[model samples]
Target: MSLPRIAIDAMGGDEGVRVMVEGAALARRRHDQFQFLLVGDETQIKSALESHPNMRGASEILHCEDVVGGDEQPSKALRRAKTTSMGLAVNAVKQGKAGAAVSAGNTGALMAMSKIALRTMPGIDRPALAAVMPTLEDEDVIMLDLGANTEADARNLVQFAIMGAAYSRILLGRKPRVRLLNIGTEENKGFDRLRDAAADLQAAKGLDMQFDGYVESDKINRGEVDVVVTDGFSGNIALKAIEGTARFVTDLLRSAFTSSLRSKIGFLVSRPATELLKHHLDPNNHNGAVFLGLNGVVVKSHGSANAAGVANAVEVAARLLEDDITNRIAKDLAELGEARLRETNGGAASEGTGK
Candidate 1:
């Protein structure tokens, strides 16, 4: 049997090579059938490896002279930093040297580089990032497009729906209920693009997905939508706001716990529940985002993510690889295009006639 290989960006994040090496090592221990290739400055990577004897024989390093910083413009970096560590890791996926790529580098640069190297699949207008969000229910929800494409049309939203649905099915082991993110439940609401996308989604065929119509932001965690679709701009804002709110609430609770003797006693009594909540809200458990609609899997981890977080990202990549999500997504997207075209042309003659 062949082992799966993941390319790691050794020079990314604040923790750098130590976390990258540790993450790869941790993942390898669980599944000895997995291997990794760390891409970065060869000397720095080797020096990092020398500090850990356990990983000496487990991984290989690929030399790359440059590294793209987090603040660098993605478009400019794509042209100038072709040999950077992040670029090399993603390029390996395009070249078929690895099954998947995992990077904790600049999100914009990674997204741009992945698209440039791997290209989007046929019929996918623009790729988007879909991250797993913990829901009030026992499981997780998949949401997109986390700032990959800020401006989207009706067609783009429909494409996101198709891609997100396929991802839910492939990763979650069942078809998900799809919902368009909107301010209201009525079909007449939302921007013109969202309204049109709702219709397109409603009439869409061959997706084998359940469309539950428009769901408001409040319903995201209410088990009303398993897959929420929206433009990248709104989606990104929602993601950060939710994360920030979660942190704020946690901090408030910590302050309360340390306030007084009574509060400390109360905290001790609620410690178990608080700990469980922390586990559920930990970003490390769900650190990876898959750039859907691409030819291959490109998993992005938070740039400040630790070894555990990177390990979680690696697990996501491995699971997607095992699930063969891209093939199913492509099939669904192709069907959506055919359905949208038929609806448009079929309605063309009836418009403005009031018939």
Candidate 2:
């Protein structure tokens, strides 16, 4: 079979075309079967490709003179969709010219363009931004609604759970342990939407998931659950808080290690262990944030990410395409529909009997 070509917004990231092109080259080395559609300025992209001989052979440049600004509003960005590098890359996926699109540009703009161009999949009212984060255990945890939508209702929350589980299956290769993020673990702790969504998930019969009820924010990184579902507003705040805390701890450790000569000596002795911890906590290692529930795959790479980060994001897009994630989501939705139908029928029968 032919390898799926990934559309890259070469002009997107803060590091400019050079970093994006280099990252694509690195990803090509990791995934030999992948091809690239490099969308950006022809002269700049060609010049950047000169530094990456291998990428030249695997990629074709699509000239796009315009770019979406980092601070541009989604509404204004939408108006420039035809000429912007990010827009063109996403359009390639919608046009079937590429299997997936990856951008390290404005998050809001990318989300807006992707939704407008590709639309959401059947049974998905809104697409959620899902990303994997390091945990205390050896594996990573998947969390969703990371600022895709500010608020979500019961149905939206339930859909996020299903979508998150499907992504977990692809990444973990099995049914994932899913949970709703809430203030408390008790059944009646959260608001009406949380309780309603929990009930729906509990009653869902055909979903390939293990719903583990509510999971408090404090336990998110404990590796207790494989997937955590929540509203975008909450999820975004939690994600940022986790990031900030990681930075704080690392900074404090650095300060402690260099406080005195004795501490410096100790740091040298523990350098290897510290290096491993640094690698584990590096944002570059977890650079991909996917917009799930879209008709086609779209990965949002961090705007300030380096080459390694961009490569990781590209790899994520390729994996989703290879795993046929969209189809898996559709199947899960079909199962949910069947379950709902059965429940309705059962309720009607009980009503008719009037016991």
Candidate 3:
């Protein structure tokens, strides 16, 4: 069966049209059923399409010349929503011209445009930025509120957990183990919002995943937890710290290997292991970050992503569309949302949890 047509902001990435078109073509190669609405400069898109005949037959160009700058603020970018490539791609999703939108642009601008154009889904206070991060185990972890909102109440955190768990169900193909990110695993640790969110999740009946309490940042990539929920401020800081650490380790290894003749010989002996590590650590393998809880699907690709990374982002959008993720989240909300959690008292729910 054919997948939903994805709208791509072809001029949004660092390399602009060439890399975006190539990536879409690469994605179409992987899944021939995939089709696209390429939104960007008409001439540039057409020129890029010439090398990818496969894309020519499967894709259509929307011809948007205006592009959102990487440094532009969300408020400023909001004004160009009708004309900018990123805005137009998101608009295509809102207008039902495409099933999902993919962009490797200014994240704040993309988030702003998406929130305004698609709005939040019913029962969602705000949509969080969720992404797949590699873990020690084969199954990657799903983390959210990466930078969408700086603060979240207990209600929003509960909603984020629900959304993250639903996303995990899709990615993991089973009930996932969810956890709140906190300084400690103890019940009284962190603030009331953390404890309150945990309480609500524990009380909620028939949730698809297991919510066993909080997790520390050190355990995030350990593969023990499936979802890590936190406010944007904390989540974003954790994300950057993790990224910086990875870069630090890799650079350290490079410097070590080239330090002397004995080290270079050792590197040759360990080349196979290092190559495996390189592949595992490559961000291209996990390039798509989703705007969960939006009325329509929108994916954010890394601005510096190459064609392979862009292809992964496109494929991520495809998979979400195929599964009808938004409606599934809506269904989950309808069955057990704020009403169920808010109405149930803390004492009774705590007794039920036996904690």
Candidate 4:
């Protein structure tokens, strides 16, 4: 079956046209049924496509010379929604010209444009930024609200959990193991926001997820948790910390290996193991950061991502489109709505009895 065409902001990333077109070409090669609406400078896109004949045949160029800058403010970029490459790509999704949009542009700008263009899905108060992180297990872990909203109350956290669970189901193919990111796993450990969200999830029945209480930051990439939910403030901090630590380890290993001839020989002996570690930790391998809870799919690729990373982001958009992530989240929200209604009614009855 043919998949829906994905709109790519071909001029949004660091290397712009070249990397973007190459990435789309690589993705199309991987998923032969994939197609794209490549939005960018007409000349640059056409030139880049010459080397990737496969993409040339599968994509239609949407000429756009205006581009959202890496440092431009979201407010500033929002005004040019109709002319900018990133804005036009997102508009394609809103206009039904594309099933999803992918970009490596300014994230704040992308999020702002997408929210205004697509709006939040029904029952979602605010959309969350969700991304996968490398884990010890064969599968990766999904974490959300990385930097969307600085603060989220219990209601928002519950919504995030629901959205994250639906995303996990799509990506991981199982009833996800959900957890709140907290300082401690104990019930009384976190602030009211975390504890209250946990209570609601526990009290509500029939949620398609296993509410696994809480997980500490240390355990985020330990391969035990499936979905980690938290406010953007905390989530962003944890994400940066994890990224920094990974880099530190990689740099340390490189220096150690090159420090001496003995270490160099040892590195050669352990090259395979090190290569596996390098692959596992490469950000490009887990490149897509999805704006969940949107009416349509909008994936954010790392600005520095190379062709492989961009390809991963494109594939992510394709998967979400094929699986109908919005509908999946809608169904999960409906179930949660039923559960919340039951909880409210049960509470009302208890209050009336004065027991």
Relative to the true structure, candidate 4 reaches a TM of 0.98
Per-residue lDDT, model 1, residue 263, is 100
Off by more than 4 A, model 2: 353-355
Q: lDDT per residue, candidate 4, 39-154, as tens digits?
A: 99999999999999998778999998899999999999999999999999999999999999999999999999999999999899999999999999988999999999999999
The TM-score that candidate 3 achieves is 0.96
The residue pairs in collision within model 3 are none
Instruction: Give the clashing pairs for model 2.
Output: none
Q: Give, for candidate 4, the lowest lDDT window spanning 10 residues.
A: 200-209
Candidate 2 structure, TM-score to reference: 0.98
Tens digits of per-residue lDDT, candidate 2, 1-355, equal: 3567999999998998999999999998887788999999999999998888888778888999999999999999999999999999999999999999999999999999999999999899999999999999988999999999999999999999999999999999999999999999999899999999999999997799999999999999999999999999999999999999999989999999999999999999999999998999999999999999999999999999999999999999988988999999999999999999998899999999994
Candidates 1 and 3, the one with greater lDDT = 3
Give per-residue CA lDDT, model 3, range 222-288, as digits (tens): 9999999999999999999988888888899999999999999999999999988888888889999
Q: Is candidate 1 or candidate 2 better by lDDT?
A: 2
Which ranges in model 1 have alpha carbons more than 4 Å from their true place?
1-3, 50-56, 337-355
lDDT of 3: 0.93
- Candidate numbers, best TM-score first, in rank order: 2, 4, 3, 1
lDDT of 1 by residue, 28-110 (tens): 66666677888988888888777666666767789987888889999887985468999999988888888899988899999
The lDDT per prediction is 0.85, 0.95, 0.93, 0.95
Task: Give the true-structure RMSD of model 3.
Answer: 2.9
